[model samples]
Target: MDIIEQAAKRLEELRRAGVEVAPEPQPSVGETARKVGAGSTAPADAQGVAQSRRVELDMNVLTAHGILTPDSVRSQLGDEMRVIKRPLLHNVSGKGAAPVKDANLIMVTSALPGEGKTFMAANLAISIAMELDHTVLLVDADVARPSLPEVFGFDEERGLLDVLTDPTLDLSQVLLRTNIEKLSVLPAGTPHPRATELLASEAMNHLLADMAQRYHDRIIIFDSPPLLVTTEARALAMHMGQVVLVVKAESTTHAEVRNAIAAIESCPVKMAVLNKTTGHVDGHGYGYGYGYGYGYAAKSSASAART
Candidate 1:
């Protein structure tokens, strides 16, 4: 099937899901400033600030796993990510075409589990950090089934949920500063059964505004759950500037992908990635990998039929 047609099918799913793609006015700056600008670290000897801890990530382990090789390494993975992130960086810096609202906020998800969305999200954040002017904030948004702890070799730590649940909590308290200098992580904290509801709450919106505004130089990447398997991702998508749906090459049925895209139709910008293919394209052995196209075409008029 033509990959553009596959992307067309993905857009159709959003229509069926009753998602709106129209743009809304951006939130006022004052409404968002309070939640942002805490920086990567907390202040020392602040009053009543006894509970603050920093988490460290293992770069050597990640390198061994191929999740992170040096940016200068001449490899398919490095080159591919470079292509994948161009439009994203454009969206972030507003240097390409038009500026995207909340452009700094990005979510990586798939049609279902075991599709490497988490892997993609992690690596994407690290890859973005490789840039000279950008920093990365990786959030494990899959609260119910988070994988950041394992992916980054960090233990259970306080994170996004802790602040949402407790009004007394400050975001600076939970934000983790990694040894990577440019990369920081916000893990899914203590699981909550009402993860979906929490993500959709008013508090979440305000927090997202703050996150979007804070660290104007930072790109936020959320590793979300499979669209068809979890409600949490749908809620999280509302706060994001861009959505990247990872479709496992031959393994993911067209119907599955269509459904996944439909779930997040309301998102203003969405991209589809065809993952894990075996081929020798672009003069290299690009095996079992992915390449995506921005839903560069109109999103609302997309159409497709199930076989």
Candidate 2:
């Protein structure tokens, strides 16, 4: 069959299985901002401009519209989660993207919980998978609080935790495919006796190394726990080639952001993504110009939730 015919057949199969595989994400506040900026004729430095653009996603759109979450679990994650995707790609490329076969590791982290790190990771993975021809791997490295499986509505039958504890499990068995084409997932796996130890183990290192080798054109993103909550985030950060710090507006303290930045200094951090923030909040009404039409955000908040 031709490529179009094959794609149509695949879509039909997925639909028959009740898999929602629409190519577009809910319209994001950032999308409009991007469109507005795209028309500019100014020749700005790519790196400088990329750093200023925060990675943003609409979590409310996902939750209200029933879009998938990081853990694959469907829920009303009230706050909006937004993140920049290009900065992430640039960050990965800087870490020696030679050979195009070594899928660089990206750790999405936050200073505190509820700052939308997992949300950012999941959506960013989805965005990358959709935008790039390369395959994407979203790894739930946050074993202490595994959310990747629930976000995508998949169960952690065998994942990082399982693979680390038992070297016998085939990596293919744990690498689950998602509704999004070219997006595979490695869940945190079933909670083990020593989750932290497993993550820090040599076997875990080997496992990640092997996966990178196998999926050369792919990007692997890790949804890790909050840096302040546990040492796991810091430990895993060392292994990653790039770090995308998700900082919540108002909620994330300045000190916390600084500390988080300091911790990630070892790795070449891609620019940080400010998330779940509004320009103004008054009596349950939020007004924020995410450089996108604020009106669109309200409409999308309702429409994208069920999508």
Candidate 3:
């Protein structure tokens, strides 16, 4: 079946399963062509949303082997990282040799909708977790769109918001183990009308601060929403040690990127991940399994250099 039909069928299945599926926005013919062309040339973080004649890849198939490969995460990231943002891997892996800090938080945000911020967050978390000896926690902070539960197959009754709202709730109670050995996920709890308020609460801060201490050796990645859409992302950005912005080529105006950066300029290192990227962006394939060296690289490279 065609892309539209497949998407429709998936939505139908979701509805049959009692999950509410939002209506898929239809793009104009001109807009459709533009997205396809843009997907081909977009930067690393932005290129994953392609107009392919295929259904969403089954996460079950990927996990059937009992291990999550770098290629599996890379493929989920789509073509954008392949082209424009590939250099980011080097930048993230090449930051100066600095003293390593504990699980400093990283919040992934975008300027506007459809920039693929959550998609990048999920893949990046998995990629980071794959590094030998490293553990990673991927938090779905975007309660508005809540993709983690779907991506990792977790129930919505238990998660971050629930724990944050209930003073008696323990963080460990909400943490769910995934198929990946070192990766754990905290899905966005059932949608709440007061999501922003919940995210901004002191309880949330205490939860994260405590989580940082408990998972000191692991990386905590918050997959937040678009800054332009709500203040939630900006609020979360303040707590993070680093904010990685995913900017889509062509689709994202330069002004949008600058404004998002300017809003959170206080962040020590706000790395840009250009998605829907073109291959020439980074100037190399650096494809999966170039060497064990890639696996050994630590995020201390992402720490603020003395420079």
RMSD of each: 13.5, 18.6, 18.3
Worst 10 residues of 1 by lDDT: 298-307
Compose the digit string of candidate 3's lDDT tens values, residues 1-307: 4435544554454344344344546689999998777665422323243221112334564343122345554442333333322333333444523422331577888899766666567767766766675677788899888865554444565677766554434566566666566777877876666678767755566567777786766678899989888887887877776777878755799889879988777665577776554344444442221111112211110111111
Ranking by TM-score: 1, 3, 2
Q: Score every model by TM-score.
A: 0.75, 0.63, 0.64
lDDT, candidate 2, 45-74, per-residue tens? 442221111112345544543444454443
Name the top lDDT candidate.
Answer: 1
Per-candidate local distance difference test: 0.70, 0.60, 0.60
Which is superior by TM-score, 1 or 3? 1
The candidate that achieves the highest TM-score relative to the unseen native structure: 1
Question: Where does model 1 exceed 4 Å of error?
Answer: 1-42, 45-53, 69-72, 281-284, 288-307
Alpha carbon lDDT of residue 242, candidate 1? 91
Instruction: For candidate 1, give the lDDT.
Output: 0.70
> Looking at candidate 2, what is the lDDT of residue 89?
61
What C-alpha lDDT, on a 0 to 100 scale, does residue 14 get in candidate 1?
33
